[model samples]
Target: MVVVDVQNDFCEGGALAVAGGAAVAEGITRYLREHRAAYDVVAATQDWHIDPGPHFSDHPDFVTSWPVHCVAGTPGAELHPGLDTTGIDELFHKGEYADGYSGFEAHACGTGDAGAASSAASSAAGRPRDLARWLTDHGIEAIDVVGIATDHCVRATALDGARAGFAVTVLTDLTAGVAPDATERALAELADAGVTITDSGTPS
Candidate 1:
């Protein structure tokens, strides 16, 4: 499955915008056009948050707190208009609470509750309707991931996919970096975790 976070808040001029974020959507569309029937499914993840969620406040772990972004019902939360989402079968929303950097721990997984079942289910749920679970549920194992902001959501989803036992391949050309440095770090981390990173021009 191809997970694209082409949300307005991550694109240029929006809250928490990433550099060169807009271009990722074009790359993803191109890839999908070429590989539409090669895979059984295609999905996207959206950072759908509500105002005053925990992520807005300053936290010591982060360099600085970000302004309200990806708020529900706001323009910033919508997917980029340029993306052709016709083939996408699912839209998973994450970050309903403060500090929602990872799509794997979104409210869809029941991460907010403290019960043991919730925690187990959260862990089992992996990323919100993640590629691995979707594949396994349908008796598949391979997945190709493509999306925006390689440094954060993309990286987290890829890494978690590998850990969840899916044969994960990240399409490098279909992704944009949050920053050069963070992108480099995420690539290193993903490589160390056994993810196969390849350019879009290469065969999956």
Candidate 2:
């Protein structure tokens, strides 16, 4: 399972706050607690930006560019408290110096962090670990994605997972999007690419 960008900056009071983002966080924790045995690996991605030149904007277009968020070494970049990440094995941090929208982007890597991300999630630091490579190494064949914004990073990550030849599924009930129309479009896009659109309650 892949949890994408459940950081403070994407939650309720975040810099790029998504409506219902915090609820999604809480819901994911509950799902993980109940369904932890359903998967072999539980990995997560965070948007840890550090001078992402054109990606961070003083006046964001809210499409290509966005307001500064998830900057390295700040409270906004930390994972949301609502997510109980006890089972996350490894963490990937992306968009350190460029605009990365996918967890597949290899900006940095970390292993083991306490619930404090206590799994040691990457944040513009740690050694790089290409996501596809990590999954391949673990012999992960299918993926279930859940997280903050359905329209952005979650979309990118699921698309990339499919392209990498994994049977990908996005647990929609565990995700929050930045906008409604965008969420609809994103789901359509994922469906077109053969990514399954489902809920956590469904058997995987």
Candidate 3:
């Protein structure tokens, strides 16, 4: 399972606050608890922007660029408190200096620390790998995705997963979108990409 950008900056009271973000965080934790055994491994992805050039905007238009958020090591970049990541085996951090939106763009870092760099000294396997590399190394060919901003990061991650030849499924109930219409369009795009659009109740 892949949890995408369930960080504080994406939730309520956050720099980029998505409505229902807090609810999605809690829902993901609950779903993980009751269905932990359904998947062999679980991982999470976080946006960890540093400089990111024009990705941060003073007069943000809300697309392509956004208000400064998920700055490295800041509380806003940390995972949401409502999310229980005890079952997560690894974490992938992305966008240290760019507009990265896909979990596939992330690199695995050892768990416990939020926004840890992909170049961290080690991971569960003693070396960091991009999401696709890590998953492939673990023999993972299919993935279930859930998390914040269904129209953005969530959508990107699922699409990339499919393109990488990993069967992908997005649990709609466990995600919050930046906008309703965008979310609807994202789901449609995912379905068209051959990604399974389903709910948490659907078995992996």
Q: Pick the candidate with the highest TM-score.
A: 3
Runs in model 1 deviating more than 4 A are 51-54, 58-64, 106-132, 202-204
Q: lDDT tens digits, residues 14-106, model 1?
A: 787776677777667777788888888766777777653545865422233566778877899888875777777656667665545555544
* lDDT, each prediction: 0.70, 0.86, 0.89
List of clashing residue pairs for candidate 3: none
Give candidate 3's TM-score.
0.91
- Leading candidate by lDDT: 3
Sort by TM-score, best first: what order? 3, 2, 1
| lDDT (Cα, 0-100) at 101 in candidate 2 | 92
For all predictions, the C-alpha RMSD in Å is 6.4, 4.2, 3.5
Residue 156 alpha-carbon offset, candidate 1, angstroms: 0.7
Query: Model 1: clashing residue pairs?
Result: 54-98, 55-98, 104-127
How far out, in Å, is residue 141 in model 2?
0.3
Give the worst 10-residue stretch by lDDT in candidate 1.
106-115
